[model samples]
Target: MEHNLLQAFTTRKHTVLTSSKIDPTGATSTGSLKVKDNISTQGSQEKLGKSGEEEKNLKSNKKLEMRAKDTGSFNIKMNPLNKDSLDKPDENGREEKSTESSKKMQTKKSETGEGHDNSSFEAHQETQGAKGHHGNQTTTAKIQQTTAFISKQDNKRQANQTQIGRSGSNVMLDVRRRDCSKTKCQYVIWQCHHQCMGWGDRLRGIISVYAFAILTGREYRISHTFPCNLKEFFHGNKTLWDEKVITAEHATKRNIKLFGFLPTFGSWVLQSSNLSETFPEDIITFRTNNDIIPYLRFNKNFTKTIEKAFSMPIDDFHYVTLFRRLFHELFSPNKQFEEKFQKYYQLLKPSNDSTLVCAQIRLQFIKVSGMKNVFKFLQETIKRVGKSKLLVSTDAENVRSAAKTLFPEQLVDIEGPLGHVDKPGSGCRDMEKALTDFLMLSKCDILIHSPSGFGQQAAMLKYPYKDVYQINYAGVITNLTIPIFKLENLYEELGPLGGEQPPSLPSRYIKNPQKYFT
Candidate 1:
């Protein structure tokens, strides 16, 4: 019996989980079942022994007649197949002893349900409870026990251990990382819808953008960086330039003077300064027009600048040159000019300087040697009403020659020393020179003028005119009221008297028969 029991202990087909392999403190191992801590396993066995005794007594006390008693404890019985048990027969004398033993075996197998020793299960539970109560094991030992328990139920397992000591405690990290939202940065261009008089309108938009850039220190690359649609800038048809369109920065940077276009330059750049402070009136453009003059009047800056530029009596030629230089500075869009105006315009105020300019238009009479010009009539009209206002028109050369001839005593024949006299529609530099020459004279409240475009410019000055006059050969003096006039009638009447009448030379004049009849 001892040998059989020893053999059963060794070859019971059980699994062993030794503490030496699991927990360093050592644990109990009977079959595959591992029970940690020897004390708990011993206690569990003691409890099981008590339960067995109690179960035996309960079975003995049961009444044996008709019904089977249901005792929770599993029933045990001896094997009936053994020769020792077969030797006994029941009182019925028919092998009842063997039959009873077989019945007990069947009952034990059925009652136990699981074909395992219950004592081992009770021992394992007690061991786990003790380990949980103590809580003194390393994480590795705990993990091993837990894994073993889970492996008993599930076959599949995986491990992913990581050392997380490097990264700071304050930083939170995800095991799996991803990118942020996807969006693109872009820009758009806006445009306008109508027909403006000329490039004046187009340039106005350019100037506006340019001014904004300069004021805010923003950069505007006219061609490559800021390729604008012309239609956006103007009200007419859309245009795609085959070549690069000219830009204000080009002329400003190159320091080039654009003639016939000064009015545009004046309107765009100088106009703003007129409202702010007295800046140099220097301007150059490739074109000029009445539209430019209206712009000056309408713009607060140009009006202010012009008012300040000519506010004081400009007497000396040096002063005039200084004024011209100052004027030019106002018109230049270079960074230097921008900074200067931003500083000066802010300081200038209407109350600080209230000086007004006095304008006069002097139109010379006609000469038979010179041909008729309609520009003179326009000049005479402006002279009539704009004597007090700043006049920008000029006289015809014939009318100017006539003035030199007739008013030789009052006005000197200052011949051809004028620069920029070749500008188209300049009216022979009469307006530019007149503004400089008589800017300080303070004489001639009214312009005593004949018909000429030059006179029209002088009439353009800001003024109230009952003070201007338009003189004709008939000595019929018209008031200085109208801003424009017609000289065609005057020229017809002043022409040679009639047909067949020899042209008589006026006093102090010689017929240029050699230049013509010769």
Candidate 2:
């Protein structure tokens, strides 16, 4: 009375499908099954009208048979006793139908000399045609998709592992791959609109600029004007170097310096001039520092201003937490420095808990009287801490030789980075040496340094910084304000490192790259 169509297709299990029809009165059947979208579902059914004529032809035998046959049209039938059948027959009729169906099936098998072998073969080529089924994707596709996903996850895990490898060294060089792949707004350029000062003063000014960037809620990158290209030393990307850094800015700083000492007086303000043409809308108001804020003062009002700018509570007053996080995620010594540092560290690392003193005396700061004071302090310090080892890192070779002569029994020193010039070729070599020396001092149990920028930077790099010994002009060595590590250190990382990483994109600079990368 009606037509039904079945298809062969793939599913989660990728099973093959087949359909069967019975000729109740020897009717014709003709159709083919297909997979995927290859076949249509409209089928033919012409039955029952010729049943009387067919029955009359077989009445002489007084028997009925159920078998599959092919004619111009399909004629499918089912007995009441069959579970799939629509009719429900009485108990007697059901028994009779079962007996007749079984006898007919046996007769067909005997005629063929074998039973149907359902498990003898896999699904034919007909079934393999379809790529997918309703609500189920093909197994092959699913496997390929899963494999791609796992590969990405594995890459990230390996990156994090590489980051952990740096823990053996003194510098906290955790290299978490920051996912800055998202589209980013233009980043503000942070540089001291000046270049006439020494590398030390320039570095401090750069730090101040960075702090401003952090407070303003805009992405920031440095514009290194010194001879040593910071981007090259740190292995940063060329795209991030701010090629458009205003040269006029530097000229202005130099011009003002010629006239007086007050050029640096009110320079720490967010002005239209300081705002890079690339990112002008980042700060709403242009204002100067209320009082030229010192480097170490995370003073109450300044602290509040930063907290409000970021709209969060800053629990650590020293801001060491913030500064270290920034340093770890931004600056890293290159391969040469790393290998050199490891070599020196192994050579100097103490065998036991015996107090190892690392003295970072700047040649510029050490005078005749101060030199005597330093000698006295070293002797007194050695006597006070038994089995103590001494390591001195200084800018001048004379200081290195003097320390060695004074304490012939202890390890003396390595000459600090060859006079501090800031160019890439020879200057970079000097930078590398300084980096190694910084690592040497950081690894020692007791750190001693003077007010020199190079020495100060080394002291600040070490955690529990509060224990660092700062030597005054009087040659007195004592720990200044003890700097402690912040909770942020546990998760912050030095974005992606090395040249081979996927270049950072502004879009992927997620609000918190660590949460996802970790």
**Whole-model Cα lDDT of every candidate shown, in order:** 0.23, 0.35
Worst 10 residues of 1 by lDDT: 121-130
Off by over 4 Å in 2: 1-184, 191-202, 231-305, 308-322, 350-354, 415-417, 422-426, 481-518
Kindly provide the TM-score of model 1 when superposed on the true structure, using C-alpha atoms.
0.21
lDDT of 2 by residue, 1-518 (tens): 01111111123454332112212122112211110110111111111021122224334212211210111111112222321112222344312233223222211112221222111111111110111111212211000001111001010112221221132223232222222344333333444222223343444444444555554444455655344556544544212333332222112110011100111111112111222331233211111111112221222335566555533344332233343444454556557555655565545543444456778766444332344334444555565555667888765555555556556667745544544443333455565565556656655566667545556655555543434555543333433333211111111211121121111111111233222111
Q: What are the per-model C-alpha RMSD values against the true structure?
A: 59.5, 40.2
C-alpha lDDT of candidate 2 relative to the true structure: 0.35
Candidate 1 lDDT score at position 122: 11
Model 2 weakest 10-residue run by lDDT: 142-151
**Candidate 1 wrongly placed segments (more than 4 Å):** 1-408, 415-420, 423-443, 450-453, 462-466, 471-477, 482-518
